[model samples]
Target: MAKRDIPEINAGSMADIAFLLLIFFLVTTTMDKDQAYIRNIPKKVEIKTEIIEVEQRNVLAIKANNQNQLMVRGEIIADPDKISEKIIEFYNTNRNVNDLTNDFPTYTHPTKNEIEANLKAAEKELESFEEQDAGDALIDYAYSKIDEWDKMKRSLKLFGGNDFPLINSQANIRIEVQTRTQYSLFAKIQTEIEEAIFELRDTEAKRIFGESYGVIKTRYISDEEPIDKGKLDLLDVLYPARIIEVTPKN
Candidate 1:
């Protein structure tokens, strides 16, 4: 009997408000993460690379002339097949110590056999987990190495340690021209080199049962003229793409 002062309920308005909020959120939310890929633009000045520390032969530099024929260092690679062989040999020798992590803490020094045993155990565990493909593992491992290399570069730049665009996979390789006198020639060589690397990465990931990883184009810092090659030493190698003029070292 006391329902005389009851206020009118706004059910329709409440529903409309809820619907509008939902639409607002749906419009604003980002479903997929966006990542920025940096591209270094070349410059027109005397580039001072100052790269004294030589990278371990992990990166196979394939030099090409106007033609895309691959050259290992300076020598013309007679057999293209041998390039992979050389890289594999380098990886076998230059890979980080097997002891990057001490999997077996109990043993101070595990012999080769003992290491094999550990690997077997890992395989057994993987099987039990029904992990049919170990592709993600390879991708993760490759990314970490690449990240480390990026960190190293930032340190050497005398800047606060920052992760720059770096490809660290032993899989990382290089393609260059002997001289920057001809821009068109080097551009062609760069394209061919990228395609070759893309195919190789595809094949290896398929073979190793690892997730596919693509080698992205490295960024260049500035734009430089082909003929303006000013004292371009091996320091240019540190920069994966485009010639850059760093301020003269103090």
Candidate 2:
């Protein structure tokens, strides 16, 4: 019988071949997904139409006086609970706004000056409206807006002279959702505030102030009906819990 020879494999370059194959796979492999919050961004000023891109959010804050009258966003909320519902729905306390801006849609203009002018005008108009309705049952609510604006400036301010956050993303955690959703949330908040104010007013109105204009107004302090801080705290906790995002689904 012919001698059977066993074939020997090359071992000298095996390590190098294995290393090359590992490198090749590593370069071609996809990385694991980064866990991050998603967002929907809006366009910039130039291409933005008359219904301009208003990056905004729904936020609520409650402030009440000794009268047990709740104020949301500044206006007296007659129903603290209702106002809370609206706020809770819109409030993302930890929302990272800087990221939101970076992902926002861009609107290009023929010239930088044009976009600047438009942005300025829009800002002015928004401010004017804010001032006009400043105290319209929403004095306490000012804190949230100022906080938001500060967040906006600090986040967009970094992008040259844009009046937003200092970051390039122009991302705001403010949660700029659909107009209808925004309006609906605001309305709920507003209604709650109004209800709180109404209750306070009713308490006062029920009591007759002195005939003279300068006399002090008073409520009949009854032991059973006496208001307490705990009451307010409880109300605050309970009301905001009911907030729901109400938008029609297709």
The whole-model lDDT of each prediction reads 0.42, 0.39
Q: How many backbone clashes does candidate 2 have?
A: 44
Give the per-residue lDDT digits (tens) of candidate 2, residues 70-103: 4544565575466534443333232234233332
Per residue, candidate 1 scores C-alpha lDDT tens digits across 1-250 of: 5668778886878888999999999999989988533335443445465766534433456565545466764567765555555443333332223333321111122233443454555545555444555465544545554443433333334222332222233334555554432555454444444444445444443443343423111211244433212112112222223222122222
Estimate the TM-score of every prediction: 0.29, 0.20
* Predicted candidate 1, C-alpha RMSD: 20.1
Whose lDDT is greatest here? 1
Q: Candidate 2 vs. truth: CA RMSD?
A: 27.1
Candidate 2, run of 10 with poorest lDDT: 212-221
The TM-score leader among the candidates is 1
lDDT, residue 119, candidate 1 = 52
